[model samples]
Target: MDISFGETCGCKGYSVRSDILSEYGPSMANSCGGGNFVVFMTILEAFIRGRCDLSDPCNRVKPHSEPDYEYDFIVAGGGTAGAVVASRLSENPKWKVLLVEAGGDEPPAAAVPSMIASYWGDPAMDWNYRTEPESNACLGEPEQRCSWTRGKVLGGCSVTNGMMYMRGHKRDYDDWEKSGARGWAWKDVLPFFKVSEDNRQIGTLVSSEFHGSGGYLTTQQFPHQPAIAKDILNAAEEIGYGVTNDLNGDNFKGFTTAQTNNRNGSRMSTATAFLRPASGRSNLHVMLNSTATRVVIDPTTKVVFGLEFMYKGKKKVAKSSKEVILSAGALNSPQLLLLSGIGPKEDLTKLNIPVIHHLPGVGKNLHNHVASFVDFKLNKENATQSLNWATAMEYMLKRTGALSSTGLSQMTGVLNSKYAEPNGNHPDVQMFFSGYLAGCSRTGQLFEPLNTNNEDEKTTISIRPVYLHPKSRGYLTLASKDPTAPPLMYPNYLTEPEDIDVLVESIKMALKFGESKILSEKYGIEADKTPIPECASQGEWGTDAYWRCMVKVATGPENHQVGTCKMGSPQDSLAVVSNELRVFGIKGLRVIDASIMPIVPSGNTAAPTIMIAERGSAFIKNMWNWNKPPIVHDHFSSTDLKRNCGGVRTDTNDVKIDIQTQEREVVDWHKRHVHL
Candidate 1:
């Protein structure tokens, strides 16, 4: 009776057609004004469209030849975390390292500035993973499966993720320390971020204080920031957000242009930064299309000797003369470990797997940056090319026009949102403002260029916020003993009352932000006023009720999956590894991936994930004795960055309400369109 779009197995599209179901599907029901049409159409449509969101099934592709084994350490999953780990560890030429990825490098589209849009659910670049049915968000999508778009190629999710770079508030790390995860404090881990960054102090808006210099990963101001940034900031200031120049700064209370991992208008994935630099190295063996099955362990001693992988068809063994690190990401890293029998005893036994270790936390403590969004429809005007290559081409060819555009390929923002936390310094939400709209499909096909609409659009703002400190925990367990079988994960979201509260507040903030007079005129947006059903039903429908509803709807994982193999002090029960990231009960086995996150950080996981590898490499090099200065970038988190002379801090809900209400009173704040 209800036609949903954008989730897996669902009919996903930008347009909403009211009467769609009567035209399709099982048992032939004719709710439409007349006759039944039992067309075998759903399957065909799904088959055709679904392929756009994910990779072609691995079995369908031709297999590559067997790989030659040569490495002191072989890192699996060449994503954000993997690339950093491999790059750092291999810094020693005396050591040989091999980085194996299921997908190879990226395509030209991945390198294009505006074409960052093409990275979504791209079959070649995306893992196109679907989560088990969620009770929430993928409205109007096919199949109701929550679409999980992870990267398959090198640079992992960073290659495909929205390029927002926010290291969460320092309080976040302190909490992790309080929860038994020691030595992961902000002061200690910041160096890793600095080591991995090539910070650019380009923007006059945010200060260049803490930004790193000449590091591998490129950091910059958005190329083309949808005119929304200033208006949103102004409105947020009116509403009382503690506007700051940088969200990554110490106060963590402000709104500003999002920091990104882009260079010259294109995304700078880790592969582009680290692995690509050493692609020609003879000692660096990079394997593509290879699926690692499990760690080859010694039967007599619980030592991981090598890795068993399937490249093409033949099973191959890549001996780890030194160590076998699992960088297979939050999802697959634990999956690989479980298949190798290093997990919860019950799970391994059920799958008929050998029990190498009885670590209960092998796949527990999952956290994600879950979100909810507001869709506002605005009055339309004649459409013009957006600020990307289409406009950039104008400059390239004619040496004029919108071609000089900043590639303002903005799909992101950086805001330090605050909650009603008792702690004075800590805030609850972090907002990311993506530049584009609902792309052609929510099944998330590789992004085709946006349709130059009937009007210039700033259509919607996705109000994303994670539980700053979540008590709700999730896990990844073995589906079967078979190495090929993927693990089963349950991210028991919104199962907690706190997480529910956080999202509802996030949506309200977004709603208020959109209502700001400055935002409305800039992008020409009008509020859709689509009431959230759950927000109202909780009977406690203030900020708390609204958040609960948002959680119920959008409470799925962001696929920045981690904490499965949680790192903590040895005495911690759920800990599968020490603070050093070495797996318990096993030698030469360390998890240098998102799977080792004791808790998920506040914003985009790529930056922190890479930092983990950077820090982990140091620790591993010292055999867990890494002693270095706080990872301070040229930029300082605590170093005050006054707004760019024209900014305010619109952080807390109370402050935001006051400012938002004022902005509501003054709608047309920006008099003219200023394209910088």
Candidate 2:
């Protein structure tokens, strides 16, 4: 490996730079080519010299003095949500928190902005899960089973995700509240979102009223803007979708540059953002490479007291005096719940596990953002190639360039399709724009690359039209009694006729963006029709029939799985957890992750997942009667309700809902909850 470094920052508790690298090799004077590489080497040098490196301080949670010690809170799965929960709970000196993770540390490449694709299938970083064979979608994928990537590392999916930060539309949360999730409306949860965010791009990219600062999670605009992004934004605007300066601000609809969980040039995952700053607390302890097998509950009392886990080839038990929180994410969280015999009684009995609590919703209501990728080949003269010396030098010298971005998808658009919500207030389809889709070596890192014979990878870009509010629901079940095995996931993509209709319409809308004068005439880009041989053979290219065929064959889940452990009113039979996130019929146990969402939000699940954790921690603290100071809300005040613009949301139980009236209800809710 060809690696270089400059002078060290010195060792008076300083970082490693020249001194450590000089003893090993000649000084790199003014050389600054590999910023991420140098940082990784600095940490390695620190470990060798028996010193601590603070670059990602949250990655390390030194073990406590006692090996088999119990804690006030034992947070299983140190992924996106669990990391925040453990970090916040441990703030009180009286509370000892234990965070258990199934994966190891995040690698150096994870910090590099463009290398996100590489982490998709890496066993060390990804859980490498696959959905059961689908009936209506993923026809062109391997074995007709869509690949599902979940982060198994410290930050969970936050460590392996595209790093795009998106809070779902206001109507999304309003629908949650309307569907039995009291206090989860947009107004109620906005504070939690702000509480966790340290928005570095506020005022410049987004408004300060809608964003937060000095918070644990750092979010900012991508430093390097791809030229293709500008084209997409322009074309979207030409097609009537407004160009939103801040997609996460007042109005979430329209096209805009994506805000990501990145600071400077590095990916700022929750493991680094939330946990790193809190790692020094003596009450916090993090255990990596430890899998939680089951939550030990008292059979008669039905209360969780200890957790059984596999650590270093041995099974051990760690007791939690206060509670055992499951932040294991959408897939693993429900799997752990079933493994501990807290699921459907028939399933648990069939698996031969003693039933502690018969919660039928344990692994029910599984769904994700179903999407189709439309590929286009841009003019070679204006296209970005696989590798360029200019970009490498730019990043090395100033941490700004193509290398400083989250790959090609730099801009996104959220808009309502013809088959939109009843009130026509919220957009159901989200389009992500990737400048160079297939040209790069890492093109196929996350999802399957477009089927194309072209040798050049940089000339292609893909417009991903995602069905945000999918109606096709799936379920998960235990594949085996063994705790080490993965659960059987049935995404059942495109099973619902309505879902298929939405996807088909989304494809048509996506074609308009490509046909817009800005992209076709000005940018000289054309739809890559040859990749879809079946669609091409059927009839004229870009037709409804042709696109429908392509969508069916190429459509896959966005991996934003949620609702396995559904949260709802107690009267709701499918409700596993309550609005407070506490599991029904079980004491000292809570589900504080994406699995608790009654419906997957209108955008990426990362931001909402973090918001869930922040609120969950607050709820837990309040329940315990902790005398912490009240959270301040001076920067952004929640005043007026701006309802009647966004659509209305009818109860989820309404079988025959009036689409128009539902939209109106949602709009009214937003008006009431509207912020100043």
lDDT of each: 0.59, 0.73
Misplaced by over 4 Å in model 1 are 1-66, 134-145, 202-209, 380-389, 392-419, 437-462, 465-467, 520-524, 531-550, 554-556, 624-676
lDDT of 1 by residue, 1-676 (tens): 2222222212213222222222111111111112211122222233222221111111111122554565688887788888777766766667788777777655433443443444565566666776555444443235445677778877778766667777877777777777776777776666566656666653454443455554567676644554555666687787676466667765576666666776544457777677654554556677777788889888568887788887777788888888888898988888888888888889888878888888888888876666665555544432233433334333222223322122323433334345455665666666655444311221122322234333344344454444455557767677776666656666666567666666666666766765667656655666565556645565453445554555565454566667888888878888988777889889889998877878787666777888788767776655532232222222211111112101112111110113343223222211110000
TM-score of 1: 0.75
Return the top candidate by TM-score. Answer: 2
lDDT by residue (tens digit), candidate 2, 602-633: 89989999989987887887778763522221
What lDDT would candidate 2 get against the real structure?
0.73
Minimal lDDT window, size 10, model 2: 636-645
Model 1 residue 474 lDDT score: 66
Supply the global lDDT for candidate 1. 0.59
Error of 1 at 595 (Å): 1.3
